[model samples]
Target: MKREDLLFLPISINVTNKKILLIGGGKVATHKGTIMARFVQNVTVVSPEFTDEIRKLPFTFIQKEYEKGDLEGYFLVYAVTGNHDLNAQIKADAEELGILTSVCDAPLLCDFVSPAIHKQEHVTISVGTNARDAYQAVAIRNQITNLFENGTLHI
Candidate 1:
């Protein structure tokens, strides 16, 4: 489905204690994994090769290609492999296993879309673009974050 056909709602899921699996080791995985590692306590990233950046996270790293069985016991998964077919397969497997899934750069295959997020203390804000403009989404989130930082927006 195209971006216009998809509508992404920004919501928060309490994943502090849940298991999150990231099935890639490149920049996409590193970027998402870094954000996830901030709030999630249990995360496992799997890939045959890993970038030096992702290796620095406080999470388990498995140096191997993703197998379907590797998805077991995860509450959420991000399919970020460079291969579209592989990412699609991960989404299908996640659907079969009743796990929430997000496929990088492939909105049609994603059950959820990652949004630009800002979290501090007790406040968390997320901004999505309905699968449209990501840069604008971040820009909008930054504007809101500015208000929060300046004490203009408070809970």
Candidate 2:
């Protein structure tokens, strides 16, 4: 499969007993980490440096450069490093270990892309543009969130 064949079917993944490894400590990682926290509790972040915002998250933070060994035992990986080369390496390492990886800003290297999501009680809604148009997906998600907030849309 190629990047052009990016047909990411929208589906829900059960992350129970999953250990998520996030390889970044900047703002992007913070955002991703915060989102993951909403759904799961076992997220570990490894980066040489971290943003103040990321440090506030309830996750295990390893203050060191990422290594291939980091992907071991991880169910899912997020290559959110600011360095493109590093993200690519993380993707490669994850693939070698048969772990699903999502590289920030590089959808082609991702096995899956995180979508703009909304959760209300027992209802959850996610919007995405096949990892090709994140801005549009976020816009649509915000609109849906507004509708739900004002009672214009119901589950």
Candidate 3:
């Protein structure tokens, strides 16, 4: 997943009114939900178990195992299941419905891969590497941030 592989992706979404479905209630799911809720109106999280982090969120929680039917009528689906098989099935289901989907740690099965992101109001920076050296990308991003801070870079 090089930067080129990222192609065009949404930098920000004002979740004033959007629906997002997050599958799994573990740490990754909670992190994703926190971000999604920052911009979307409704974020529905479906998972049989909820982490303490997840329990703190104010979104709709469906404390049940994921089913194929759970994908109905959602704008986006996130498959972050600890179970790879279930995650793949959710990805397939989203594909069948023509809905956007993100599969964590399974970028090969995703329509979109979440980029390493840095954000400020009205200004967001996203960097994607080949998923080979995430730390390398993070270091580069830090350099870029420093350049901007020193007025040596402009977008």
Off by over 4 Å in 1: none
Best of the two (1, 2) by TM-score? 2
Error (Å) of candidate 2 at residue 104 is 0.5
Q: Candidate 1: give the clashing pairs.
A: none
Error of 3 at 154 (Å): 9.3
Quantify all predictions' global Cα lDDT against the true fold.
0.89, 0.91, 0.78
Model 2, backbone clash pairs (residues 3+ apart or across chains), number: 0
lDDT (tens digit, per residue) of candidate 1 on 67-147: 899999999999998999999999998899999999999988888988898898877788888878889989998999899
lDDT of 3 by residue, 19-70 (tens): 7889999988888877665556488899999999887877899999898899
Q: What is the lDDT of residue 36 in candidate 1?
A: 85
Q: Give the top-scoring candidate (lDDT).
A: 2
The TM-score values for the models, in the order shown, are 0.92, 0.95, 0.78
- Score residue 146 of candidate 3 by CA lDDT: 88
Please give the RMSD to the true structure for each candidate, in Å: 1.5, 1.3, 3.6
TM-score-based ranking: 2, 1, 3
lDDT, candidate 1, residue 12? 86
Better of 2 and 3 by lDDT: 2
